[model samples]
Target chain A: MAYELYYWPTIQGRGEFVRLALEEAGADYIDVARESEGIAVMMRMMDHAEHPPLAPPFLKDGDTIIGQTAAILLYLGARHGLAPKDPAGGLWTHQIQLTIADLVAEAHDTHHPVGVGLYYEDQKAEALRRSDEFCENRIPKFLTWFDTILARNPAGDAHLVGRSLTYADLSLFQLVEGLSYAFPKATGRALKQAPRVAALHDAVARRPRIKAYCASPRRIPFNQEGIFRRYPELDR
Target chain B: MAYELYYWPTIQGRGEFVRLALEEAGADYIDVARESEGIAVMMRMMDHAEHPPLAPPFLKDGDTIIGQTAAILLYLGARHGLAPKDPAGGLWTHQIQLTIADLVAEAHDTHHPVGVGLYYEDQKAEALRRSDEFCENRIPKFLTWFDTILARNPAGDAHLVGRSLTYADLSLFQLVEGLSYAFPKATGRALKQAPRVAALHDAVARRPRIKAYCASPRRIPFNQEGIFRRYPELDR
Candidate 1:
């Protein structure tokens, strides 16, 4: 059976992580929220009393409902043989993915620092400060950390964990891509100093599957409603 | 060799999750930062050019270094035979743990909405609004979801995923306990409606190992420095 992915219909938010993996692996999956009457079906699934996902970007495989981007990716990666086969390598890949999830959360908080329910206009001042910190410290700190991992990898910088493509690499690529879209100025400055990480992002984007997915309409564009938003004030 | 845990010495922060797993399993480990000259050693270790942890709350088993709270728990849980034996059960357990991690991150952001490096005093206005949203909406939303999970557990409400105790239950106990301490008014209001979640928290705490840990000095007291801070102004 094909996996059912439920996320916000209009945004490439956290759900994009799952979409990327499924796309890269050429897996059979349905983007539920993008279809007609899909959002209502997704909301109904969430409102279910039993085994409902805590939030969106949940993947349904048969009776199993999995949420959390890292968890969903881990499930898809393991099932589709996208993660490392070695136990230690697999665990390391998961660790990196979780860290990426942390980065994603931080990125989202930049605009909604005062309240997720509040508009960016309502929380502009708070977002200004949050984004300043994110651009000045958090982004570099997280990006450099990924760079250090790639530098330390015994299998070389071609991938995050080992010699082949892992979900971590794909996620990192997405992370950098999102940052570049949302905080172009800050990302450009940071990426210059983070050569290895920049190289990895470029490599992942150049992957045949990822490139095809990027060019396809199936890959939704980033927007204000997404985790990473291109607000000029937040970028600088 | 004993397991080595590296985190900041003062707060019952993210490190507490790993601490609970270790304490519950009676695993031989050292809280590196609490030991002699340990904080400096942790700083130095973090500064290492090769194989350094991206952030704190990392575990070192001989030469292997694993970071990320959920990742660390997954490692220790499997290693100590605390995780479910079945792959499906294990993945479900991890799914819940990742959700807990998400809640923890949101909780932390309530108090430090403007910037992590900034003091609460520096961002009081932003925090006030953030905390209000967190207390009024996020807390109830997260707790009610967990309550629903417990109520719908196919095996039983005795555990989150199955009939047996899992690390997710322990983490949830810590989450509720922290929420109670940090946002008593909001938590009190929510718990009244989330009886199953409250009951699960109480049940997890009543476990001999967990009860003992709670009573022990090893369980650091939650304070303003931690993720969940008790800010009277923020709570109401």
Candidate 2:
């Protein structure tokens, strides 16, 4: 059976991480929300009393439902040989994935600083302050940390863990990609100080499969509705 | 070597989740920040790292440094037999853990609705609006979803997953505890509609290890600095 993925139809959001892994592995999967009846089916599945997902961006494999971006990616990675085979290596990969998840949450909060429910316009002042902190303090703090990891890696800076393509590397690429889209000025500034991380992001983007996915319609565009949003005031 | 846990010295915060799992499993570990030289050591460690963790509540196991609450729990759970051994069961446990992580993040945002660096007093107005949406919309939605999961459990609602204990159950207990601490009025209102969830929280609390931990000095009290804080105005 084809793996079924459920997420918001409009934005890449958290679902894109899972989509990237699936796409890279050449796995047979259905992007459920993209189909005509998919969103309703996804919502109905969520409404089920038995085995309801805690939220969207959930993956359905036969009868099993898994949510959480990192969890979904971990499952897909392990099932389709995208993660490290060694136990320690796999755990380290997960460790990196979870940290990326933290970065994603913080990135989302930059725009919705006042409240997730409030419009960005309503929270513009707070968002501006938050985004300033993110760009000046948090972004460099996080990116530099990843850069340090890459520098210290025994397997070289090509991949996040060991010497292979783990989901962590893929995620770092996506993270840099999203940050570049949402906060190009800030990202560009930080990228100057994070050479190893920048190199990895460039390398991941150049992968044939990933390059195709990025150019294809299956890969959604980044927008204000997504986690990483572009606000001129916030970026500045 | 004993596991070394690093976090802020005072509040339970995210470290409490890791502490709970370690305590429940009877694992040999040290809460580094709470010890005599702990905070200094944590700071030095952070400064010395080529790849410092993005933030606190990280764990050090010999040479490996792991961060992120759920990821730490996942590692410890798998290593010490706290999680389900089966592939499907383990994936489900992670799904629940990630959802709980989401709830924790939302709970934290209720008070710091504007910016993490600013004082709660600075963001009181925005927090009030955020708290209202959280209390009226998010809290019920999340709690009721857990209630549905409990009601739909094929093995019974005694535990969150199978009939046995899982890290997700412990996390749910902590979630309910934090919610109750941070928003007694709102949580009280929500719990009335989620009897099974309440019951599960109580049951987990009543476990010998957990009960003892709650009553002991090891269990840090929730404070304004922590993720969950008591602000009566926000609750109402």
Candidate 3:
């Protein structure tokens, strides 16, 4: 059976991580949320289910519907060659994915520091401080960690986990892209200190499938409506 | 080999989720950071490992080091039957755990809206607004989702997944306890609307091992330094 992915149609947001996995694997699937009555289908699924998904970006197999970006990646990873076959290696890869999720959440909070439901305008001042701290401290901390992970990978610095291009490497590639769009100056500054991470990002981008995905209309561009928004003043 | 748990000794922060899982399972483990030179050992491990952990609350099992609370719980749940045995069931349980992690991060941000490293006093105004949004919006949304998950559970409201307890249940118990201490008035008000979630908290509290662990000094008390902090003004 073909897989069905349900996520917001417009933004790359969390859904992009799952999309990257599906795209790179050359897997057969439909962006369910991008189909006709997609949004309604997504909402109804969220509202009515035995095992209800709390939010979107859920993947529906014949009888199973898996929610959570990282969980979806894990399920897909094992099915494909995206993750390790062994328990130890797989667990480590999953851990790295979880940390990437953390970094993503923090990046979103930089723009919506006061409340996600509230407008960024209402919390501009608060966001300024949040962004400043993120740019100065969090970005360096996270990128350096990624750089270390890359440097320490005995197989090579090309992947975040083992020698293979796991879901983590794909997610990290997206992360660097999102950060560069949202806070270019800060991310650029951090990237200088994380040469290995930068190299991995570039290498992931050069992969045939990912490179095609990026060049295709299938890959959504970063915008103000997405989690990683660009507000010039806050970026400073 | 015994599991070696490493985290900051002072606060029942993110590590509490891992701690609760181990304590409930009656797993043989050492809270390494609670021992002497524990902090140094943790830092050195973070700096020296082939796959260095980004932060603490990492678990060491024989030769492997597992970071991320949800990842650790996933590993333990599979090996110990603390989670469902089936792939679908396990994935759903993991999805719930990730949502709980999201809730925990939001709860922490209520008091640290500007930055994690910044003091509450330094961002008092921003925190007040953040707390208001959390207490009024995020808390209700999350608890309502939890309540829905329980109400939909075919087995019963006794557990978050399947018939038996999962790590998600234990984490939910901790979330309730943390929110209650951090925002007593708001949490009490919200709990009235989420009886199943509230009831789960009470049920988990009565479990023999959890009860003993709660009474034991191993369970660190919530403090200003922890994720769930008590700031009377912010709570209001």
Candidate 4:
């Protein structure tokens, strides 16, 4: 049976991370929410499923449902050879993914500093202040960590763990893409300082399956509504 | 060999979640940062370790170093039998722990909405607005999810997963503790509606090892500087 992925229909959001992995592996999966009546089906699953998710972007494989992007990736990564087979190496890859998740959460908070419940317009002042700190500190801090790990990898700087392509590399590509889209000026500066990270992002982009997925209509374009918004004023 | 746990010495913060797991399992471990000159040692390790943690609350077991609170717990949970042995059940436990982590991050943001670099007083206005939404919506939404899972558990409503104690139950207990300390009024109301969750929190508190750990000075008291802080003005 093909895996069913349920997420918001319109934006890349967190679901895109999972989508990238599935696409890269050529795994048979359905973007459930993108289908007709999918949103209702998604919400009802949350309401009545044996193991309900607190939010969207959950995956149903057979009778097992997995939620939380990192946890989902952890599941898929091991099964698809997208993570190391050794327990220690696998755990390290997961640790890196969780760190990426921390940065992603912070990135989302830049545009909604006051409350997720409030509109961006209502929280503009706070967003401006938060965005400044994010661009100045958090982005560089997180990207530098990635660069450091890539440079320090025993195998080489080619991948985050071992010398193989893992989900972390795919997700890193997505992170850089989101940051570049959301804060072009700031991401440009940070990328220049972290060449290994920048190169890895580009390398992942060039992967045949990933490249095709990007060119295809299946890949959702970044917009103001998603986690990484291109609010020009907030970028600088 | 004794496990070495590294974290901020003064506050319970995220490290407490790990500490609770270690304590409950009666695992022999050293609180590295609590020893003299230990913070310097911890910082140096982050600077040079092959798998450097982005931040503290990292655990060093033999040569393996695990970071990220949930990731650390996942490692400890398996070895210590604090998690289910089955792969599917283990993943579900991790999923719940990750969700709790999301709420913990949100809870931290209530006080530092503008930036982690800025002090709470500097972001007081933003904090107040954020706290209102957190208390009114986020708390109930998260706690109710826990309650729902507890109620829906096939074995019984006593634990978050299976019939045995998992790290999710311990972490849920800590989450309730932090929320109750930080937003007593809101948590009180939320807990009233999430009786199963409330009972789990109480039950974890009374567990032999956990009970002793909480009473001993080994457990740091909740203070203003940690992720969860009591600011009466924002609690309402």
Candidate 5:
């Protein structure tokens, strides 16, 4: 059976991270919410699955319903040669993935600072302040950290973990892409400060499978509805 | 060799989750930063280690330096028998740990909505508003999810992942403990709706090793500087 991935149909959001890894590996998986009965299957899992997932962007492979984007990638990474097999290498790769998660959450909070359910207009002032601080402080801090990691990677800066690409590399590509889309001007400045990181993003984009996926309709464009929302007022 | 755990000495913060795991498993570990020269070791790793950790609360076992509280727990969980042996069970355990991390971050944000570097006094207005939404919407949503997971657990409601104790149980205990201290009124009310979660918190506390650790000077008191800071105005 093809792996079942449940996420919102319209927004790439957290699901994009998992999708990128699956795409990069050319894994057989269904973007369930995009399927004919995807939404219903997702709803049933949310409502009544034996091991109900805490949220969407969960992967269902047989009996397991894996939630948390990082966890799903971690599961897939080992199986697909996208993660290290050695214990220490695996742990280091996971540590990097968790940091990427932190960056993603902060990106989401830049737009929805006060409340997730509230409209951006309702939290406009807070969102603006949050976004400004995020662009100035958080973006540089996180990007610089990643740049440092890449610089210090004994294997090479081409991949985050070891010689080959791992889920962390895929996730970092999505992070840069989302940040670049969400805050074009600020991301450009940050990219200049972290050239190696910029190079890695380019490298991941150039991967044949990744290149094909980017051009395919399967990859959703950044919009106001997703985590990396482009609000003119919030981003300078 | 004793695991070297490096974190800020004063605050329980994220490190406490790791401490709780180490304590519960009867694992020999050194709280590196709590020692006189501990801060320097942690600073050196941040500044100059070959694989510099993104932040503190990193664990040094032999040569591997693991960062991110959840990542640290994931590494220790298996070795200490604090996590499951099976692949699916381990993944599920880790998924719960990641969700607990989400809750911890939200708790931190409730007090620092505007900027992390800024003092809570500087961002009191925004913190007040953020905490209100957090306490009302986010807290209930997260707690209710945990409650449902516990209710639906086939192993037992006594633990988050399986019949055996996991690092997730230790972290959830700290979460409930922090919430109770920081938002007594709101947490008191939230606990009423999540009796199973509340029970797990109580059960973890009563564990002999955990009980001794809490009673000893090892367990730091909850303070304003930590993730679950008490600001009377924000809590109510």
Candidate 6:
């Protein structure tokens, strides 16, 4: 049976990370919420599944339901050879992915600094302050960390772990994409400072599957509603 | 060989989750940063370790170093039988852990709503708004999810994953501890609404090893400096 992926239908949010993994693995799956009446199905699953996911971006594989993007990737990565087979290498890859998730959360908070309950307009002042620190400190810091890891990878600078294309690499590509879209000026400068990370992003984009996926309708475009919104004022 | 646990020496923060697992398992481990000159070693390790952790609360067992609180527990949980032997059961435990980590991150952000670079006083206005939403919505939503999962567990309601104690149970206990410390009024009210979750917290506290560890100095007291802080103004 094809795997069922439940996430918000409109934007490349956290679900995009899982989508990249599934697409890269060439795994058979359905983006459940994007289909007609699928949002209802997704909500019902969240409400009544034997194992409920606190939020979307969950995967249902047969009787098993896996939530949390990193946990979902951890499940898919091992099964799809997208992570190292060895115990230590797999954990390291997972650690990197968790760090990426942290950065993504921080990015989301740039706009919703006061609370997610309020609109962007209601929290604009706080967002400005939060985004400044994010652009000045968090982005550079996270990018530098990714660059350091890429440069220090014993196998090669091209991959995050074991000279293989792990899900960390895919997620990093998505991170860079979202950051650049959200904060073009800041991320552009950070990318220049972290050339290896920039190169890795380009390399992942060149992957036949990822490249095709980006062009296809299946890949949602960046928007104001998603985690990485391109609010020009906040970007600056 | 004794395991080396690296984290901020003064605060329970994220490291407490790992410490709880280690203590409950009766594992011999060194709290590296709490020792004299240990913080220097911890910083240097982060600066130069092959698998560099973006931040602390990393564990080193001989040559293997694992970072990310949830990832560290994933490693320790399996070896200590704090998690199930089955792959599906293990992933379920990890999924719950990842969700708990998400709540922990949100709890930290309530005080640092503007940015971590700024002190809580500097972000007091934003913190108040954020904390209001956190107490009024996020906490209840998260606690209800935990309560629902506990109620729905097929094996029993006592454990988060299976019949036996898993790291998720321990982490959930720690989460309740932090929230209660940070927002006594709100958390107390929320706990009353989540009786199963409340009972689990009390049960974990009374466990022989965990009970002793809490009494021991090895368990740091919750203070204003940690992720969960008690600011009466912000709490209300």
TM-score of each: 0.97, 0.96, 0.98, 1.00, 0.98, 0.99
DockQ of 3: 0.87
The regions of model 4 sitting more than 4 angstroms off are none
What fnat does each of the candidate structures reach?
0.80, 0.71, 0.88, 0.86, 0.72, 0.86
Tens digits of per-residue lDDT for model 2, A1-236: 99988999899899989989988888888998899988899889989726778778999889888888998888888887788887767877887888888789989988886566779888777687678778887788888888888988888988888888988899999999999988999999998999999999999999999999999999999888999888877786
Least well predicted 10-residue stretch by lDDT in candidate 1 chain A: A46-55
- Candidate 6, after superposition: displacement of residue B58 in Å? 0.5
Q: Give the alpha carbon lDDT tens digit for every residue of A22-48 in model 3.
A: 999999999998888999999999999
TM-score of chain A of each: 0.98, 0.97, 0.98, 0.99, 0.98, 0.99
lDDT of predicted model 2: 0.87
Spell out the clash pairs found in candidate 2: none
Q: Residue A29 deviation, candidate 6, in Å? A: 1.0
DockQ, computed on Cα atoms, for candidate 6: 0.89
**Tens-place lDDT digits, model 6, residues B1-236:** 99999999999999999999999999999999999999999999999988899999999999998999999999999999999999999999999999999999999999999888989889999999999999999999999999999999999899898899999999999999999999999998898899999999999999999999999999899999999999998776
What are the per-residue Cα lDDT tens digits for candidate 4 across A12-106?
99999999999998999999999999999999999998789999889999999999999999999998999999999999999999999998899
Query: Candidate 3 falls in which docking quality class?
Result: high
Going through the candidates in the order shown, the clash numbers are 0, 0, 0, 0, 0, 0
- Docking quality level of the chain pair in candidate 4: high
Q: Give the lowest summed-lDDT range of ten residues in model 3 chain A.
A: A48-57
lDDT of 1 by residue, A1-236 (tens): 99999999899888998898998899999999999999999999988836677889899999888877888888888888889877778888998898888889899989888777889898888889999999999999999888888888888988888889889998999999999999999999999888999999998888898999999999889888899999998887
Q: List the residue pairs that clash in candidate 4.
A: none
lDDT of 5 by residue, A1-236 (tens): 78889999999899999999889888899998898988998999888865677788899888789999999999999989999899888888998899999989999888778777788888788888888889898888999989998888899888888899999998999999999989998989999999989999999999999999999999898888999988877776
Q: Write model 3 residue lDDT over B72-180, tens digit each, in one string.
A: 9999999887999988899999999999999999999998989988888999999999999999988888999999999999999878898899999999999999999
Q: Report per-candidate DockQ.
A: 0.78, 0.65, 0.87, 0.91, 0.76, 0.89
lDDT of 5 by residue, B143-188 (tens): 8888888888898788887798888888889999999899998888
Give me the runs in candidate 2 sitting further than 4 Å from their true place.
B49-51
